[model samples]
Structures are given as structure tokens and as C-alpha cells.
Target: MKLIIAVVQDRDSNRLSQALVWEHIPVTKLASTGGFLRAGNTTFLIGVDDDRVEKVLEIIRKNSQVRKGWMTPHMGGGNEGDGSYPVEVQVGGATVFVLSVERFEHF
Candidate 1:
């Protein structure tokens, strides 16, 4: 068996859940906090047979996305990357993990 761990943005948690359910994939969801950005996140725990690993990975890949931070020119024709140092807020993305499950049990 394999344990699939998907960490996704809180904004798209509901959508991801619905899609997984549509594929008949069972998941255990947990609300979590992002480490770098301190934003909310959703963690998904899914246990499936070994053969289904690829399918589960595909689902996560389709949903969890990497976002880019756009920088622009500031006053005095200085680029954002210039050492002028403008204070702006930005959030980091999500992470995912998968591991082999030796055993899983339920009451």
C-alpha cells in the first residue's frame, strides 16, 4: 500500500476534494498552516493500493500549482529587484509527499 500526502492551497481545497471524490479516491483532509508564508493549507491523506500510485499523483499534480511573483518597476525607474528595497507581501506555494505504508488499520 502507498500513502499519498498532498499539501494544497486552502483556496482550492474544496475543488480538489470534489475532483478526488469524483475519481472514487478516498482522502482524509486536514487544515494546516504554511511554513514560509503562514497562509492556510489543506493536507490530504490517501491510502491506496500500490498500482494506483500514478493515478493519485496525477490528481495532485493537476491541482497543486506553482505561482509566480510578478515584479514591476518602481519610482525613479528602479526595477523591483533593485536594492531600493520595497516592502511587499507575498505568499509561498504548496508541497507534497508520498511514502510506502507498511500497514494501515481502522476500527
Candidate 2:
């Protein structure tokens, strides 16, 4: 068994969930927040057979996407009125972790 942890942006969560369900992959979804942007994120916990790991990863890769956004970054001890500029940033991607499970049980 393997444990797949996928942290995706909220924008992609619905689409990813639907794709996973279509592939008959069971997932446990949790609401989470991203550290960098402090934006909403969704965490998916999926337990699957070892051979199915690649399939699950492929699904996540296909659904989660990276795009650009404008952000006003806080500068040197100043407020938003302190001449802040909008910086283009990359967002909307998934952070995935795959681990080998020693055992798995369901009741």
C-alpha cells in the first residue's frame, strides 16, 4: 500500500476531486491554507496499491495547474499605502508526497 498526499489550490480542488472520483480513486479531502500565499488549499489523502501510485499521480498532475497572478508584496516596514507594486507570481499548483505504507486497514 502507498499513501499519497496532494496539496492543491482551492481553484483546482473541485476539478481534481472529480477526476479522482472518475478514476475510482478514493480520497479524503481536508481544508488547508498555503504558507507562502496564505491562500486556501485542499489536501487529499489517498491510499492505494503500490502499482496504482503512478496512476494517481498522473491524475493529480493533469488537474493541478500553475498560473500567474498579481500580488502586492509588503515592503520594508510599510503599509499597503507605502508604494507597493504588484508583482507577478506563479500559483495554482499541487505539492504531492508519496509514501510507502507498511500496512493499511479498513473497518
Candidate 3:
């Protein structure tokens, strides 16, 4: 067995979950926060046979898309220690991992 973990954007969570379910894949969703923007995110846990690894990855790949992130105003352009450094950044991206599941139990 393999455990598939997917970290995705909040907006894409529902769509990704639905797509996984449509493919008859069961998953667990957990709330998460992004590192850069501290934005809300979703982490999905999927358990499947090793043979389905590729398929699961495909679903995650389709759902986990990179989106533009908000940025603050730029500071310290000329002034030193002005306490403001802002610029546009891209933050919405995703990561997926597949690990061996030696044992799994549900209560």
C-alpha cells in the first residue's frame, strides 16, 4: 500500500477532492497554512494500492495548481531601516508525496 499526501490551495481543495472521489479514491482532508503568505491551505491524505500511485499523483497534479499571491507595498527603496519591504510574489503552489504504508488502521 501507499500513502499519498497532497498539499493544495484552499480554492482547489473542493475540486481536487471531488475529482478524487469521482475516480473512486477515498481521501482525508486537513486544514493547513502556507509558509510565505500564511494563507489557508488543505492537505489531503489518500491511501491506495501501489499500482494506483500514478493515478493518484495525476489527480493531485491536476488539482494542485500554482496561483499568484498578494504582495505588500515596497519599502526601503532609498531609506534604510524603514521597516517596509514589499513586492509581488507567487505563492500558491502544491506538493505531493508517496510513501510506503506498512500498516494502516482505522477505528
What's the residue-level lDDT of 94 in candidate 3? Answer: 75
Stretches of model 3 off by over 4 angstroms after superposition: 67-92
What value of lDDT does candidate 1 attain over all alpha carbons?
0.77
lDDT of each: 0.77, 0.90, 0.83
Best by TM-score: 2
* Residue 80 displacement (Å), model 2: 21
RMSD of each: 6.2, 4.8, 6.1
Per-residue lDDT of candidate 2, residues 1-107 (tens digit): 99999999998999999999999999999999988884899999999999999999989988886878888787555765877898999867899999989989999
User: In model 2, where do residues sit more than 4 Å from their true spots?
Assistant: 68-89
Writing each residue's lDDT as its tens digit, candidate 1 over 9-104 gives: 887688778888999999999999877664789999988889988987777777656555445336468555576644453433457777989988
lDDT at 43, model 2: 97
Among all windows of 10 consecutive residues in model 1, the one with the lowest summed lDDT is 85-94
Query: Number of the top candidate by lDDT?
Result: 2
Q: In model 1, what lDDT does residue 68 have?
A: 50
Clashes per prediction?
0, 0, 0
The estimated TM-scores of all candidates read 0.71, 0.77, 0.72
